[model samples]
Target: MQLITAHVMSKHLSLSSFSFRAPQDSPEKAIPSRKLPFQTFLSFNPKKPLSLKTHLPIMQISKTLFVFCLISCLSMTSSQEQGATAYEMLEKFNFPRGILPQGVRSYVLNTDGSFEVYLDGECKFGVEGGYSLSYGRKITGKVSFGSLRNLKGVSVKVLFVWMGITEVSTGNGELDFYVGPLSASFPLSNFLDCPQCGCGFNCKDIVSDS
Candidate 1:
């Protein structure tokens, strides 16, 4: 018959390629397709594993670095007390801008050194052993290094009463002057200059001295 019908159609195409094989992977279906992308990245109460988009950018970068380090430490403490004055902070604590007099007009020290001095009112005068002092348009206390304590608006003039210098200090070279429990000393070249509020320092060298 035509060569036995082409050998039974070449043995039916080699038994359809060994009954079509190919599939193989199996460790229980490849571990649920590799745990389906780690269970869609959990966080649905998986014991609260940090997920407010990971603590909201770490609390917004720690509150923007604590408000930019508190406005750069308050602008470097107001640029180091701005124009610093009070007679250059009483020569930086050693004191003696003639113990303050000549219409100060304004002040305030405080960094625990406490102060306040202002003037242009309530003054008084006379100095040089005849004493007299006075000066209360506001003055206050607490200084250090060479010292000055409790003070409050000045005063002096003993021998005719009116006493309350409260405190002042220095040492060896002298310049004491307290009040209660009495004290006195002087001679730090008797306060360089700066007195006139009602005309003091020897009448500013007695007018026309020629």
Candidate 2:
């Protein structure tokens, strides 16, 4: 009777353990038993797939990138309209800003490349190499890609007399300034600064000379 009762108790304990253990042969049924909230929703409806938690961050990132690009484009357009100055315009024509002196109060540039430059007053300054130049109140010229034609209101002192520079041209890495039938050529690097009136190359020297 003791042996039969021990056998019955062991058989009953084995049945209870088997009932509590998860079955390995059927993983599909076990998935539903431990399904997450989002998993349950997806299982119910196969047509609507993505959850809000998964897609919300992607939408937010896309919106942020779009706003950043829009602001950048607007800033560039505003700068092109308001930030462009006369010196920067000269750069567009492949000329150095130093070709024109400072104190440009106003200017008019036409679509045909003809332009007029107005200074604060007549600019007269002696360059470093003993050359005195004078620019009139208004200077008119037709500017091409690398040449200037029909230039007026500019002159240079030669000996005791000042002669007008009627034509100016640049090519072959040199700049040519013409007066009537006479012309002079200098290296293109010479006109890098627009000399100031009455100051020459060094204003301090002019002050000392005075």
Candidate 3:
């Protein structure tokens, strides 16, 4: 009876102390950690600077593509328009080249008859009508057969106040420039040659045909 009780007590102690542990090479031990490098994608770390090599895939390239297309279209259009000089184009529309001043830096003419003219800077001069004319660096308008309408960036001085030139008409050997309700007519021969800035057509530096 004494031996039986001792053996039972030893068995109870052994059961309580025993713990089941898997082998060192078990499948659970071979699995990787949950906190991996790739899991924290595009995450900023105060101690580490950004690296494009790892985060390039997440960038938005749509805006860059759109801007590139827009610029390419404009360049192609500008190149196509350059086939003809601005003055020559004016002649083709039945308007004299002299209507525009000298030193045109560039111009863009659209298929719909809308055009933009660019100059180095503002140009101001006096015409025979005793009126002072000023031309802005950028001029925009629509040109049609024998007429320039919707004119902007061209102005005239009347009674110490500057008034914009709204329209121009050419026909019957006469040229008319409109300043509000008033219009001035000049002979077509006056515009045979473009006038130079600060020196009407009577430029002293120019040599005569003789």
Candidate 4:
């Protein structure tokens, strides 16, 4: 009986020792910390002045900002060169683009203030009077904001007489039309309405064939 009791006591002590022992660490968790030269220097000299190591990040940031701004400016210039149209160019010169009727096929503007405007073909339509107005296939003139000179290829009929309108000048909110030595003044507001190729001031195709 004594031998059996000793055997049972030894078994209980061995089981308790096995269960209470600390768990073994994994290979990754047991890895030892490695201190690099720079890390060791920083840890030893915390109050030391920052060297190029600290300023390198700031320099890189500055370089990045400069590149970004340069790219933005280049993109803006590219868009302006490609996006601006002929009508928008008219606005740039401070003139309303409506002065030219619709169906303008093309135009050439010179640096010396001269310009040539082209229509698809000859355009004619009746105006306020029973008389008719006609535009040739091409018109050439010197153009400034609110003014056109040496005009050609446009004509109007008045009182059964067809007169060539040679020049147009603007001032005091009025446009002066020159037909030979005679001139007529009309409100500048009249040009706000863009004319059509075959309908003159009418855009809704209301002009009758009669």
Q: Relative to the true structure, how large is the alpha-carbon lDDT of every model?
A: 0.69, 0.66, 0.73, 0.64
- Candidate 4 lDDT by residue in tens digits, 165-199: 89887788776778999887767676666677777
Q: Backbone clash tally for model 3?
A: 0
Where does model 2 exceed 4 Å of error? 1-83, 204-210
Ranking of models by lDDT: 3, 1, 2, 4
- Minimum summed lDDT over a 10-residue window in model 2 is located at 1-10
Q: Every model's Cα RMSD, please?
A: 26.2, 24.3, 21.3, 25.6
Mark the regions of model 1 whose C-alpha exceeds 4 Å error after superposition: 1-52, 55-57, 75-81, 91-95, 98-110, 114-174, 177-189, 193-210
Superposing every Cα of model 3 onto the true structure, what RMSD results?
Answer: 21.3
Clashes per prediction?
Answer: 0, 2, 0, 0
- Model 1 lDDT, residue 33, Cα: 23
Give the alpha carbon lDDT tens digit for every residue of 1-210 in model 1. 011111123543443223211236533332212211221333323234434344554567678777777765554332125687677777677767887877787776655676777788898887767878898989889788899899988988888999889888887877898998988798877787777866677774677674
lDDT of 3 by residue, 1-210 (tens): 011111113433333333334456665543232232441433534235634344343333545556667765654444225588778888888878878888888997765677899988888887886778888999999888898999999998887999999999999999899988999889888887877777756674445632
> How does model 2 fare in lDDT?
0.66
lDDT of 2 by residue, 1-210 (tens): 011111113443332222122367755444333334432333343234635464554567778777777765544332124566667777676666656777887776665667788889998877645778888889988777777778888898988899998877778877778889998877767666655667755765667889
Q: Give the TM-score of candidate 2.
A: 0.54
Runs off by more than 4 Å, candidate 3: 1-82, 205-210
